[model samples]
Target: MLQGKPLLGVTLVITATLLFAINDATNKYLLVSYDVPLVAAIRNIVHAILMIAILGPYQGHRLVQSTRPGLVIIRSVCLTVGTLFAGLALQLMPIAETTAIIYLSPIIVVLLARPILGESIGIVGWLAALGGFAGVVLIARPGGGLDPLGVIFALCNVGATVSYYLLTRILAKSERTLTLLFYSALIGAILFGLAMPWFWFGAMPSNFEIILFLSLGVTAGLGHFCFTAANRYAPASVLAPMTYSHLLWAGILGWLVFGQLPDSWGLAGMLVIAAAGVAVALRTRFARR
Candidate 1:
């Protein structure tokens, strides 16, 4: 059923990416004022509260009832890990470079989904996957991209994202969207709080900074909404590569908000990566029929 669903999924997925890119702007802003764990904690804490306000009284209760408790737990852990790695990489690498390297998650997801999701692969799938991988090389361009530690964390970001996608597919069969989100945030908040003791160094924030810290949760909560919604109509393997939309927007956001931009070589490389991802998505759509 190519029935416009994936097309809608693509559009909605890009919207979600833009939201995430904007959220990244807010998050990188907070990094200067806060430790990584605390930044993560504040986001989840505010998100849990915001969800309560928006959903208003246990409407998703039964939806939660429908979920497999085990998979939900896994989903939550992967999300926290992904966020942690992202924050760490953000601290270590340029925002644009980190975002580009993390685009490898789609490639990882395609590799993992076969056994994990019991999906079949064909020659075309392999070809597209290789094309996507090649695109990563172009974006990095050896003498360019990110530092070694930055590459490792970005690759770890790919690993965490793959795990998150696997968990999402596991839950796709039985859980409701609101329930998935509610439990994911609930679990993430708990784990983040627990991790605080290892890295807990901070002064209490000023009132103004406090507000941005709280947006930590708000933007993530909103981005996850768009993310989860996309998963319902399209598989992670389908939506995964499309997330490179982050790279282009990150450059713009990095410049407009942070007063930084990549050199022409980096921009040219990123354009190829983004175009490669889109081409594969379009090819997949055609191959589906």
Candidate 2:
């Protein structure tokens, strides 16, 4: 049996969050110079290549095998949509606001679980979900420095990610983690590749831009790997709260990279959403206890 290692798990979760934040920042930076689809396609292609190079030696063809192939493909498509939407949102919005909006995925999952997974949410869960939605409105409201289109994209990302998480929960019982990971990368790469030629521009990117695009794949793959590894050491209850650290990283990146800061309302909104998410995570954790 795997040993419980909360400390290691927490460390890994925080590391993964930081890496993901960096990936978002770099992706946003790249979007200033490349079309959304082109950037997304390159990132997914690099991710798929890395997945094969890293997992192929040991897992070989097993990486592609899935007991629930249909669910796996749906999950992959959901992830692809989430990634693309997030990239497009980041292209148009501040990282802090975008990250805060995407954070609503957990709340969305709670609301969705009832109908989809037949899971029950108590009064507190309902309140927490409401609080998260309120926070989203506060952040997206007028004078919040967020573009309307970006808000739409972020909301779409939340929807896609909620679906992705739900599928992950159902598929985890029958699928290998590596297999799921491989399918996500492979499906994203293939789908995005097919769409890239239409969005392709002949302009060559600088060496630095190329490196940033490459780093997106590295950060994405490694961040997910660390998160998966973290869960092996500690239950989701222990790692979920640590994910809030992503907001901190997002704030810092937003300020450092783009010199953009969320207004008072936006900051308050982010805090509320973070608070609600932590409350829900802790409630579920102790409830299981």
Candidate 3:
């Protein structure tokens, strides 16, 4: 039922997943030594600079062109807010747990699309979303030693991400990919820059920290680029399951980097959430048939 260069798309998705996993782990490590807002601000600024430098000449003035400026700006805001929240959550929570919770964004987008995009969700979709939420609850259970504030931040990230995805759908038909990508980074940089003064710490980062800070932008840029490129090669349905590989990468990196592993409940929760997200994607795929 799925079409396009499945092999290439699958490979790109897997690559993107791995990069994103590494990005998350790196973010968590840096957040441990720096304030979350400062980390987010610097990351966004670097990302914005890299994107503009690489894409500006190719896109020329059309880089910023958008048929739907309002929606584009709103989408950018969502991305920025989501990044900040996720950074905060990573500071207080384990990488694997934070990642699993953030994975709930795709499921939330499925539900949110019903009202916001006038898309319909079948009974299976509803059940899958509930199952995903139940998984999140397990991971965030009381006395689990997880920070309550971190969990809240994770949920907030999910909310903003859902909005971002929804707006992406609305803008995809009218806006160029570079245009959308440009705005996402530009707005994030501007917003983060505005808040930098308050979050800036006087402590100087080590050279290694500086390298990781720079790689944050590199990974984020390349990850999204690969994911977007994959879509051009295959249907989203075919690539959707590949995204689950992120959990595996996250788990491995979390263990290697922080010596932290998700416990039984947390592991089970991650699995359930991953399964539910795949289910939701499959449901949408089959429905289109």
Candidate 4:
């Protein structure tokens, strides 16, 4: 059985969160001029190619092997759908706000862990989840001036994310991390590649933009690899709150890249979310003692 390494898992998750923030910022930048599906396709295509070129030579069939094929497929589907929604939302909303709303998935994951993963979340965990939700409400509250459609897309992403994380936790026991990452990359590449013709109408990207396109896969592939690997070391509940780090990364990227920053209320919301994550981490640490 995979051994528990909570500290390592938390560190891996935090690393993944930073990588995912960079990926999301890059996607938001490209979505301005490229179709969502087209951008998503390139991201996945490069991801699959990188995986095959890097891991295939060493692992070959082992990279695709899985004990529970059905669950892996379902998880891949959730990730693919979530990517679409996240892309659409990014096109219409600021990265930080879109990410803040989507971070609600971690809270939902905490709530679902007991029933879905047979993992218990004590009272502190439950309260942390509620605090996280309240933070999202602050970020998505009325008069926030966010696009309603973008908010909707982000919320949809939350559903997909919750399912994706839960499934990741479940599959971590029997599936190798590379196998899970490969399946997700393969499914996205195939689905979006098949649909590319309909969405491929943009001008040829400049050399710099081309590099940006390729970087999507690099960042995302690494992010997912870390994310999937972390689950093998920690339960879903412990790792869920660590994902809040994405909010901080997203906010910084949005301001630095796009010159967009959340207002006071939104900043308050982010602080609440961060505080809740800290609380959860401390609670988990103390409980272990």
- By TM-score, the better pick of 1 and 3 is 3
Best-fitting candidate, scored by TM-score:
2
**What is the Å distance of residue 174 in model 4 from its true position?**
1.2
Worst window of 10 by summed lDDT in candidate 4: 280-289
User: lDDT (CA) for every model shown?
Assistant: 0.73, 0.91, 0.89, 0.88
- TM-scores for all candidates: the values are 0.84, 0.97, 0.96, 0.89
Q: In model 3, which range of ten residues has the least summed lDDT?
A: 1-10
> Over all chains combined, what TM-score does candidate 4 have?
0.89
What is the model-wide C-alpha lDDT for candidate 4? 0.88
lDDT preference between candidates 3 and 4, better one: 3
Deviation from native of the Cα of residue 197 in model 1, angstroms: 5.3
Q: 1-289, model 4: which lDDT tens digit per residue?
A: 2637989998999999999999999999999999888999999999999999999999989998888999999999999999999999999999998887887776677688888778778998899898988898888899998888898999999999989989988997899878988999999999999998998775789999999999999999899888878978887567866888898899999999999999999889878877777677667666776
Descending-TM-score candidate ranking: 2, 3, 4, 1
Best by lDDT: 2
Q: Which stretches of candidate 3 lie over 4 Å from their true place?
A: 1-3
| Stronger candidate by TM-score (1 vs 4) | 4
The true-versus-predicted C-alpha distance at residue 178 of model 3, in Å, is 1.7
lDDT of 2 by residue, 10-81 (tens): 999999999999988998888888787788888889988998988899998799988889999999999999
**253-283 in candidate 3: lDDT tens per residue?**
9999899999999899999999999999899
In the range 57-88, model 1's lDDT, one tens digit per residue, is 65746645654788787888898889888988
Which ranges in model 1 have alpha carbons more than 4 Å from their true place?
1-12, 56-60, 139-142, 197-200, 228-243
